[model samples]
Target: MAELDKECLFCKIIQGTVPSYTVFENDDVKAFLDLSQVNPGHTLMVPKKHIINLLDYTPEDARRYLQYLPAIANAIKEFDTNITGMNITTNNGASANQVVMHSHVHFIPRFEGDGLKLATRNNAEKYTSADYEKIATKIKEQF
Candidate 1:
């Protein structure tokens, strides 16, 4: 493992150099209210260790980080009666809009009237069965 980045914002929060409204914390993970609340109960969960992104996680790191997500999400939901749904997401690289270098999972509480929407375009081209098989075969080969 690498040494903790003293300048990292998440690291600062974990070290108590910066203040945070921490909702949960354990030896391996921490959950806190997001500064930019997309909804009433938006929270951010992060590994206690400094990992750049999802691709950097070891299997143990991945397991420790993810195991608490369900309980944390449920706690957020129970905290507010207005929450109707939730969106949990983690962006990897800058191309995927990851602003922070440290990997973190976002727990966004959703309400029916909330303006937030995930936009997607159906720009995919049609493929033949053979093309699908070829694509699957290529991916399977890597595994």
Candidate 2:
């Protein structure tokens, strides 16, 4: 837990400052329906204690947060059995299109490219296994 902005939408939801279609709640985590759904039963999970992004979360918080994934996935599956698969995304920075400043995970069910599009860059730079290992090491070191 850390200092939080009472005005943040997510913070307000966590505090019961604002209304939400919440499906789950506990001492450390909260899950609720997304206002904008990519698919029916789309949901967002957040830590009860405010954290700005992945960079602001601790390992313990990350572990606890992840513990709720199976339940969320099951709910999505139950709601849309036709879903062939799913995607979990969390954006950290503005360039990544993270509209909300608060940290949260999006659970979106995918149905045969129903809502997915990505452009390929044939000549894009590539990283080797060793290069990726170095980057991973640096990221872990920052935490």
Candidate 3:
């Protein structure tokens, strides 16, 4: 947990002010159905404490949240038996299209050609193995 904004919607949910159709909850994490489902079993996972973005999270918080992610994804798969793939994503600032101020991960179950189209224009470059190694090394430095 870090400094929190009491006005954040997810914080309100954590405080039991706003209602949620929660699928899972632990001492520090909450997983619930997304109000606007991209697919039948769309779920949102959040820390009970407020965090604004992935980059803002502490390593300990990340480790704790990650421990629950697989379980949540497995539950979604079990709920929708026919799911073939899944995408776990988190958005950051408004420019990145994050609608909520609270940090959350979206679990989107994917079917073959589910007609989902993501931004491709900025993803034009094909990186080499060396490039990936460099990027990975840089991120590891921060950790």
TM-score of each: 0.91, 0.79, 0.81
Count clashing residue pairs per candidate. 0, 0, 0
* Worst window of 10 by summed lDDT in candidate 1: 118-127
lDDT measured at residue 135 in model 3 versus the true structure, 0 to 100: 92
Candidate 1 regions exceeding 4 Å error are: 1-3, 124-126
Weakest 10 consecutive residues, lDDT, candidate 3? 116-125
Highest lDDT scorer? 1
lDDT of 2 at 140: 100
Candidate 2 lDDT over 88-139, as tens digits, reads: 8788988878888999999887887586753446632587788889989999
- Please list the residue runs of candidate 2 whose C-alpha ends up more than 4 Å from where it truly belongs after superposition: 1-3, 118-143
C-alpha lDDT of candidate 2 relative to the true structure: 0.82
What does candidate 1's lDDT look like per residue over 1-143, in tens digits?
Answer: 24468989998888888899999998888899999988877899989888999989989988878899999999999998888999999999999899989989999999988999877677347877889899999999997
Q: Compared with the true structure, what per-residue lDDT tens digits does model 3 show for residues 39-133?
A: 88889998877788887888998887768999999999888667998989989999888999889999999878788766647542788888889
Residue 3 displacement in candidate 1 (angstroms):
4.4
Better of 2 and 3 by lDDT: 3
